[model samples]
Target: MPAFAIAAEDPATPDIAALIGQHLAEMHACSPACKVHAMPAARLAQTDVTFYAARVDGALAAVGALKALDATAGEIKSMRAADEWRGTGAGPAILAHILREARARGYRWVGLETGRHPVFGPAQRLYAAHGFRECAPFAGYVSDDFSLCMGLPLA
Candidate 1:
């Protein structure tokens, strides 16, 4: 397995931009237009969000972000593993990094919204493996048929 190095980066950079564009495209394709909530590169670069990129041998492997929702909570956003790196450790590595960062920042909980469609099964399992449990809508989100929200409380 290739080793992944996860680090904070600007999502608007050339390579990262292309990856995020692909991520957005896939999200839109698999979910209804109204249910697709993947953020564009510009939004991922917002002051309240910290974006990260995972690389293997200096090549981009995946991307993920943590957005501050409040003084004690955060939301995971824009998690996408490059097609070539899927099934590798890229996804989990980047996820662990985000969780670690959340803890270091003293967050009480981290939540994420993902599609409830079968296409998102793997992602749902990934989050579950990391101790995320099904939860109600958070951070202004409302209960919806197309969205599944999960949360992991930091102890």
Candidate 2:
């Protein structure tokens, strides 16, 4: 497979929307709670925020977003990699790229909420490997059995 490139762009872009659709589909396919807990795709696509995607051979392989929560903090949202691309380092690559962009934009800390179920083990491992540690919920999210909160300092 070709090397992947992560690009920072508007999620409103058509290509980005397609990638988001694929991401949401994969997440929902893996776990129904993804759709239950996730913000609607249409709403996410319309948000004005920093969005990133990993592209391989000009096709989107993974996508994520960093929404500014405050001057010093940002929230990781809509993180997903295509099923075929999972376990290929694409998710971590996309995450690292998102963090770099977050730091460049002046965020001191990045936070994220992901599913806590056994089905999400790989995702949890990916976040851990990238230096994200468990943390209390940030933003307006409530603690829930189906969710886990994680954070990392921007270097």
Candidate 3:
């Protein structure tokens, strides 16, 4: 089996597409109609967005992306871990890898939007542990009761 690795690889791969679709579906199911902010695979394929897949033993375990909101800021988008890999380190590993990528790209800040539903508690905690604090609406986001926005400022 190949060692676990993350790369800006093919988001068109079936496994990656299925995982991202599940993520968007769950978001739409949990949040109100206007608050469903998950991006589609086609949007993530744009030049400003860098999509990554975490692979374990050659199987796709998780997927995420960093979308340049502007020159100094980037947003974490479409972050989802496959069901079988939830409890594994795949989520955090992918998150950490993306943050490093954001920093390398000269972003002074990183932000994300996640559902406020109870089901998202673990995800909220994961971002909090990595220094992303609850913050106001950013970029094109508007304040909504069902959404929680978080941001971390880099040195």
Best by TM-score: 1
TM-score ranking, high to low: 1, 3, 2
Sorted on lDDT, highest at the top, how do the candidates line up? 1, 3, 2
How far out, in Å, is residue 55 in model 2? 0.8
Q: On residues 19-110, what C-alpha lDDT tens digit does candidate 3 reach at each position?
A: 88888889878888788888888888989999999998788888999999999999999888899888888889999999999989899999
> Model 1 misses residue 6 by how many Å?
1.1
- Backbone clashes counted, model 3: 0
Expressed as tens digits, the lDDT of each residue in 71-147 for candidate 1 is 99999999999899999989999999999999999999999999988888999999999999999898777657788
The TM-score values for the models, in the order shown, are: 0.97, 0.82, 0.95
lDDT of all predictions: 0.93, 0.76, 0.88
User: Which residue segments of model 3 deviate by more than 4 Å?
Assistant: 1-3
Per-residue accuracy of model 2 over 1-155 as CA lDDT, tens digit each: 45888877667677777667665665677555533455544566555566777888877778887778888888888888877787787888888888887888898899888886687798889999989999987776655776788999886
Error of 3 at 106 (Å): 1.1
- Scored by lDDT, model 1 comes in at 0.93
> Where does candidate 3 clash, by residue pair?
none
Least well predicted 10-residue stretch by lDDT in candidate 3: 1-10
Work out candidate 2's RMSD over C-alphas.
Answer: 2.7
